[model samples]
Target: MQKAPERLIDENGFRLDGRRPEEFRPIKLQVGILDNPDGSAFIEQGKNKIIVGVYGPREIHPKHMVLPDRAVIRCRYRMAPFSTEERKNPAPSRREIEISKVIREALEPAVMPEYYPRTVIDIFVEALQCDGGTRCAGIVAASLALADAGISMRELVSACSVGKVEGQIVADLFDLEDKYGEADMPVAIMPNLNKVTLIQMDGKLSRDEFERAFEMALDGCRKIRNLQAEALKRRCEVLTGTEMPEKGSLEAH
Candidate 1:
């Protein structure tokens, strides 16, 4: 088990990386990053680096699992063997299995699977590096990939994690904070729908604390949602040769 931070927060109210309590680590998103996948994206948030690809709306194998009225959503969340301080086993761990199911469920609400009945949409997310919050980061990238792949959807799903560390509620818990924090909660929301798809907690917290952390997580997700939109916009521009607006303007005048 990982041990707690000797000091989760300094008297100056900064985390070990000199971040403020409510601050999220920097995030970088790029869409259509892979050529083979129908849609793909890459993200680097804080110390976590992840890549996600969306494939299909293709036929489902083992045909019996196919839904007559909607498409099947399959998600695989994996961590590279060298992603952590210690080499993770190449085989999936129990936590990874649970997280895979969590991610699939979290993204289901945003997809209009009914349009692609008898098909399947497969999402693959792999972590190249991690410090914490990899799951939420994966959600952001996966949503972008889905859009890049042209999957019909109601809205993108965004996610973030918040927790109480050192008796202070902080947004975007990292490795040390999570290992020692009193509470670590990860929340995913459909950005435009304003509905939560997933909210899981690993530690105890008072109702008041939970409410505050929940709001913080939502706020973080909103910020991430904007970034995701921008990524998709940029990807579109690149594909349509609209990067130089003077000749091929996407903006209406």
Candidate 2:
């Protein structure tokens, strides 16, 4: 088996990547980037590329599962055949199922499901390229897609990952670092309320290190929330042919 690359330059620095101990990679997001879906978004953070599509509040099939007083959020997460270093099979694997469940649960609390009872909202996320933190990327993309669909939510959902590599805590682990790094922690947060909706971690961390990584991830989440909001505003302006009126401008109208 090939050994993982050594990523620690020294006890206190990064290897070749320019990121500091608690820095995230540059992120880019585009909303309504797809033509076929009711809502869509493309997101890139580091080497990870994910596209998400949301459809729904339409009708429920296999009708037995429809609820009487709330809509159901159905989520599917998949990796494209060439998304990874190794080609993946064309079916949803157990890992994808697990991630879909986690993502659905993460956004469930934020969605106003009672508004569309007996309807189904379908969200599909495809990993176009894989690095670390694909699940978190999926969550972020899904939130944007939902917003693009004009679904009411308590707040936007944003996510980021942090890790420990080379004995130092870091934010937003890239592909190589995640493969060889000591610990990886991914979190989804509701920035408006400073609350966490999703959290997961692997590897070892002392209490101090955990606190450091948690703080770093939360900061990243806030940064991502800003980006998501900007993307949504741009999309709305394009779709409506009008800019968002400045705050309280409607009162003048």
Candidate 3:
């Protein structure tokens, strides 16, 4: 059996990235970042960088996959040729297909498919850089891209990963930590209803450890939900040329 490397430590309780157990890595998001797509967004979380593009509620091609009662959500997830330390071949691997399916399933519940029967909503996410948790990051980016395209959704989706390291539960595991940590659990959440749309786990954990990790993931999701809301509000402000009113201004009116 391979032994794990020496655990990361900080005398003040910070992790390798100098973040507290529950704090997330820095995240940057931009909508409409691609020129040719109906909707697109870029998201960077720590060292992970992903771009998501959304096209349609357009007519379904091939004519046979369209359903009578609902629109289909299609997703393709890919890793760029230079996306990792070791170059990945320029082909979609089985892991990418699996992740794409998971992302599509995660977003399907948020969309109202009945509104666009016989059509298709397609999303493509490209991982330009990876350091862990690309699937969760891609899902979040896809949700934002879909919303930016003005598609209706029951709620916005937010995702993050949590893990245990050195007996501490940490949020947003980075590459090294994820590779060496005791466990990793990624979750996709619908914040309005406090429901989970996707959950995946790897590594070993006891029952209590699983519960603790889950709680941490939930908390991370809520924090990310707030950030997502703020990003959308900022985007709307930019598009409409209207500033967000002061907190008490509406009450004053």
Candidate 4:
């Protein structure tokens, strides 16, 4: 096999993609992109692309798993066979199962499950492309899909990844950086509440570095939240023939 590439961060502090340590990849979001699901959204962050659909507040299946006082939330995250360089298997992998659980937990705090007793909310996310940070992108898209469905939510969820590359903390690692970087951390937050709902870390970091990475990730999340809001506003405007609302102002509590 050929040798791997050189260090991710250059001596001038620019990444392989020419981004600074704290810069995030460009993100685009679109809401209500599908007609069948109660809500649907698509997102492109860097080279990662994902679509999510939200359904329910409908009856729970099996009847045994129903919550007496709250709606049961289920999540499924899948990667398409062509999502990566090597065609992934069609079946869900163990990693997908774990991510599904984590994503469900992240949205649980924002959704008003108590309002829909004996019901269930199902969130499905599909990865159409992969470039690292797919989970973060999925969370952001899923949250928008939920909102588009008009589900009762305390706030929209936004997420991004941060990592230590060449001893420098960087925001939004791409596939190459993620594979070679020293550490990776992904975070999800409720933008309106200013509360973190999901945080996962890998590799290692000192306290100071961890804090720096967290702040950088949070900043990225806030920016993603703005994009999410813009997507929602655009859809709303299209339907109502109104101007776009101020960012985050349309957030429902």
Instruction: Give all candidates' CA lDDT scores.
Output: 0.89, 0.86, 0.85, 0.89
The best candidate by TM-score is 1
- Candidate 4 ranges with C-alpha deviation above 4 Å: 1-3, 243-253
- For model 1, how does the per-residue alpha-carbon lDDT over 1-253 read when each residue is reduced to its tens digit? 5555689889999888898999888888889989999999999888899999999889899999999999999999999999998899999999999999999999999999999999999999999998888999899899999999999999999999999998989998888888887889999999778999999998988999889999999988988888888778888889998875543322110
For residues 1-253, could you state the per-residue lDDT of candidate 2 as single tens digits?
A: 4367654545557554776776677788889999888889998887899999999878999899899999999999999999888788978899899988989998998899999999999999999998889989899889999988889899999999998887888888877787888999989999998889999999999999999899989988998898888888778787888865562211100
Q: What is the TM-score of each candidate against the true structure?
A: 0.94, 0.92, 0.91, 0.93
Select the stronger candidate by TM-score from 1 and 4. 1
Q: What TM-score should be assigned to candidate 2?
A: 0.92
Candidate 1, poorest ten consecutive residues by summed lDDT: 244-253
Clashes of each: 0, 0, 0, 0
Which pairs clash in the backbone of model 1? Answer: none
Better of 2 and 4 by lDDT: 4
- Give one digit per residue, the lDDT tens place, for model 4 in 1-119: 22456988888889998888988877878889999999999988778889999998788879999999999999999999999988899988999999999999999999999999999
Q: How big is the positional error of residue 66 in model 1, measured in Å on the Cα after superposition?
A: 1.5
